[model samples]
Target: MKAASKKTAGTIALNDRREICNVPEPSTTRLNKRMAELGMCSRREADDWIARGWVRVDGQVAPMGLQVAADARIDVDPKARGQQQEQVTILLNKPIGYVSGQAEDGYQPAVVLVEERNHWRGDASKTRFAPQQLRGLAPAGRLDIDSIGLLVLTQDGRIARQLIGEDSGMEKEYLVRVTYGDVAADVQSAFPRAQLMRLRHGLSLDNQPLKPAQVDWQNPEQLRFVLTEGKKRQIRRMCEQVGLKVVGLKRIRIGRVLLGNLPVGQWRYLAPQERF
Candidate 1:
C-alpha cells in the first residue's frame, strides 16, 4: 500500500491514515541532569538511584534516561536518603609528600592519613571511624604534594559537587612564604606595588585571564592569597610571573571551613553542623 503525504499546511503526515499538527518542542530535561541542577545529588548519583528504582517522577518510578518537565515533582526513596546520610566528608591536614588524589611516582595519596590512628584527638565530632568510610572516599580538591594544609576528602557526592564543581566559586585561602630576588628579609619593601596589583587582578595563566585574587603581604616574607579558582600549581606559577619565589605554601581555609589546630598528617570528620 502507498503511504499518504500531508498536502495541507501546518501538518505532518505520519502514514496513510495519520496527520499531526506542528507544535513547539516541549521544555524538558533529562532526569539525571534535572536532579543535579536541583542540587539533590550529582548526575551519577541520580542515575544510580533511578537504576535502583529509588527515584520517582510525577508519582511514577522514573526510568533511566527519562525526560522530565522542569516543573515535575521528583522524589527520592528513603533508602537513598539513608545512604546519603551515611556518607562522610573528611578534612585532612595534608603534609608535604602526599598527592591529593592517587598515589603516583612513589608518593602516597593524602587519604592514607584518614585511618583511625591518625584521627585528630581534638575533633569534636562524635562520629566513630570505620573501615567502610574509606570505600569511595576521595579527594574533593587538589593540593600540590609539596604544599601543606587543609585538604578535603569525601564520600559524599553533594559536598564534592559543591567544592569542586565546574561552576563552584569556593574561596581557598593560602599563606605563602616568598622571597624577592636576593632579598629574603624585608622583601615586601623591595617588591613593587604594581606587581602586587597584578597579582590581585591583572595576571593571566595558561593563556587565560585569572579571576581577581585577594593577595597582600601578611609579613615581610609571607603573602596571603584568597582565590576562587585553582589551576594546577596556580600559586607558585603566579608568584613566578611576578619574580617572587615561593619557599612554603599552606592552605588555611576553604570557604568558611578552617584548618585550625589540625596537626599535620592528621584527619578529622567534618562536624554535622559545619559546612564548607
Candidate 2:
C-alpha cells in the first residue's frame, strides 16, 4: 500500500519502503550579510543600524555580528529608512585637472565642484542643496585627473554599490580622440580594420584578458568606446596597444545616464525618476 512515515531525531523513516532521509538544519548567515543579501542596505549600513538598535530579527533587537537564519524576519526602524532617503547622488561634469577621488599631488578632487554656486541652473530636480549632504560624499566611479566628462559622486551606499560593485557590469561610453604616429587627421582611414577588431576583443590589460568591448569610429579622428569594465586609464592604454595615441577622452554615458549639456565644473542632483 502507501509508505508509512515516521520521524526520528535527525531523519525521516519510511516504514514500508525501508528508506530514510536526512533532515538538515537551516543554514545561518551573519546578520549584516543577510540584511545586505535582502537588498535592505549595505553591510556597513546594516551594521550601523544594528549598533543603533534600528534592526530587529524575529521581533527581537538584533545584536552586532549576530547569526541569523535566512527566513528570519528583519524589521528596520523608521529612522534608518528616513536617513537613507536623505542621502543624495550627484552628477558632475568633471573638468580636466581634477582627480575623481582624493586630492593628490595638489590636484583638487571633482567633488569640490559640488557646492551650491556650481549647482546646474538648468537642473529640474526639486532637491535642495545642503552642506550636510557633502559629508561622506565620495566618487562612485573614477575619472582620471587628465580626462573629463560625466562623474558620479554620492552619499548613498546603494548607488555606490550599484555603480562600482565587484559584480557590476554597467556600461561606460566614451568618445576618444586619437592620432596614429604622423596621422592626426583622418586617421581612421589609415587604421587597419584588423587592429580595430582587436580593440573590440582580444585585448589584455594587467596580465588579464579584458572583456569584449564596443569600439568603433565615431568620426575621422575620434573613436567611440563602450566598455562594461573600468580599468585605470583604460581608454588611453587600449589605444596605445593598437598603435594609436589618445589625444582626448570624455565619458559620455554610464548605464542609462548621460552627460547631456551639463556645463563643465557644474553639478546636479540625480532625479528620482532617473536610474543607473
TM-score of every candidate: 0.92, 0.89
Candidate 2 overall Cα lDDT vs. reference?
0.91
lDDT, candidate 2, 1-276, per-residue tens? 123333452243234234344545559999988877777887888989999999999999988999998789999999999999999999999999999999999999888898999999999999999999999899999998889899999888788878888889999999999999999999999999999999999999999999999999999999999999999988889889989998899999999999999999999999999998
The lDDT of each candidate is 0.93, 0.91
- Give candidate 1 regions above 4 Å deviation: 1-24
Q: What tens-digit string does per-residue lDDT give for candidate 1 at 139-214? A: 9999999999999999888888899999999999999999998999998999999999999999899999999999
| lDDT top scorer | 1
| Cα displacement (Å) at residue 20, model 1 | 16
Clashes of 2: 0
Q: Ten residues in a row with the worst lDDT in model 1?
A: 1-10
